[model samples]
Target: MRSISVKIVIKTFLLVLVFGIFSKIYGQTDLAVKQKSNFWKQVQFGGGFGLNIGTGFTDVTLAPNAIYNLNQYLALGAGLQGSIVSQKDYYSSAIYGVNTIVLINPVEEVQLSIELEQVRVNNTFRNPTTGIVKDNFWNTGLFVGGGYRMENVTMGMRYNLLFNKDKNVYADAMMPFIRVYF
Candidate 1:
C-alpha cells in the first residue's frame, strides 16, 4: 500500500513538472503576440516556472496566465499556478492559486509590474516513527510581488502570507521569465 501511494505521488509530480516545462517553452514561442486596431502588441499572455527554496524545503511552481493591456501604463491578468514541494518531515504536498498582475511602463526598455495572488494549500504530513498520517490542512493566503521587464525577459520577486493562524508562514521567492510575442 505504501509503495503504491508513493508511486502515485511521484507520477503526479512528474506530470506537473512536465506541464511547467511546456508552459515555459510555449510562452517563449511566437504565438503569444496579439494584434489590435492599428498596432502590433507584445505578448498578451505569459507563463513561467519558478523554484522556491526555504529552510528545510524546496518547491517548484508551474504558473500560467494571460494579461490584457488596459493602456500604456496599466495591465491586468490572472493565472492558475500549482506547486510541488519537499518538506522537512519527508512529506510532500501541493498547492494551487490564482494570481493577478498590474504593469507600469516608465520607459521603452523598462517595465515595472506588481502581482497579487491568492492560493490554497493542501498538505499532508506523516509520522516517521509510526508511519501514521498525522497532519493535513487546507490554507489560503495572499502574495505580493513586483517585476522588471527588459525586452523579452522579465524578472520579479514576491512573498506569500499564509492566512491560517496555525500556518502563519511566509514565503519569499523570485521569478524570471522570457517570452516572445508574435
Candidate 2:
C-alpha cells in the first residue's frame, strides 16, 4: 500500500511540470514583443530659456532638447539653441547652435555628462568713428562635467575643453548649469 501511494504522488508532480512548460504556446506576450512595444516610453523631453533686459542691453535665449534612456545607467540626446543679444549701438549678435550629449549615471544621485556643440555667430559692432563692422565665425565647444541629481532635476558645473579667449562667446571656461527633464 505504501509503494502505491508513492507512485500516485510522482505522477501528479510530473503532470504539473508539463503544463507549465506549454503555457506560452500562444507566443504573443513573449519578451521580445513586449520590449518593442514599450520603446516610446523611454524618451524624455527637457530644455530651458533665458531673458535678460537692462539699461541699453537685451539678451534672449531658447534651447530645447530630448533624450532616450536606454536604461538606468545610460542616456543619449540632442539639443538646439538660439540667442539674440543687443546693447545700445555698441554691439549686436545672433547665435545659433546644435548640441549632442551623453550621460552616465554611476549612482542614483550622481551623474556624469559630456556634450559637443557647434555654433554660428554673427556680430555687428558699431563705433561712432568706425561705423558698422560685421564679423561672422563658428565656435565649437566640448564640455565635460558631473552633477548632483534630484528626481528630474540636476545642477552642476562644466568646463569647456575648447575655450578661446579672443573669439569665444562665454567669458570663462567653467560655467554652472541647471537641467530638468519630464
Candidate 3:
C-alpha cells in the first residue's frame, strides 16, 4: 500500500511538471505575439507551495494557477493542485483538485477571493490488527477569504466554508497561500 501511494505521488508530480512546462512555453509565445497589445498584459501566472515535516508526519503540496484580468477590480482564474500526506506506520494519502477562482481588488494591495473546487482523494491506512484499508472519494469545497496583493506577488489566507468533517480529505481550517506572477 505504501508503495502504491508513493507511485501515485510520483506520477502525479511528473504529470503536473509536464503540463506546467508546456504552459510556460505556450505562454511565452503568446506573450511575444501580444507584446504591443494591452490585453495580454493582464494575464498572470501564479501558484502556491507548502511543506511540513515533523517527527512522524509530513505534508507536501503544489498548486499552479493562471489568471486573466477582466478589469482593474476583477480577475478570474483556474488552478490545479496536488498534495500528499504521510504518517509513519499509520496512513498515507494523495489528493488532487481543480479550482475556479474569482478575485476582487477593492483597494490597492488588498484582495478578496472566492473559489469552488472539486477534489479527489485516496487514503491507505495501515492497522496493527486489521491489516490494511484503502478508501477513495471525491468532495467539493467552497473557499472564501482575503489576501495581500503586490505588484509581483500575493499572499493570502482562506477557509473552506463547505468543508465536510466526516469524509473530506482536507481539514476545516485556515489555509495560507503565496503566489508569484509573471
Best by TM-score: 2
Model 2 TM-score, all chains together: 0.80
What TM-score goes with each of the models?
0.55, 0.80, 0.73
lDDT of 3 at 164: 69
Cα RMSD (Å) per model?
Answer: 21.9, 9.0, 20.5
Mind giving the per-residue lDDT tens digits that candidate 2 earns over 1-182?
99888998888888877876676554545766778768768888998899999999999999998989999999999999999999997999999999999988999899899999999999999999999999999999999989999988999989999999899988999999999989
Task: Show where candidate 3 strays beyond 4 Å.
Answer: 1-39
Query: In order, how many clashes per candidate?
Result: 0, 0, 0
How do the residues 26-136 of candidate 1 rate in per-residue lDDT, one tens digit apiece?
Answer: 776635443343233533766777798989989898888777767766666778888888788777777777877766667655566666666666666677776746444
The candidate scoring highest on lDDT is 2
Model 1: runs farther than 4 Å from truth? 1-43, 50-60, 86-89, 130-144, 159-170, 173-182
Clashing pairs in 2: none
Q: Which has the better TM-score: candidate 2, or candidate 3? A: 2
Pull out the clashing pairs in model 3.
none
Judging by lDDT, tell me the better candidate of 1 and 3: 3
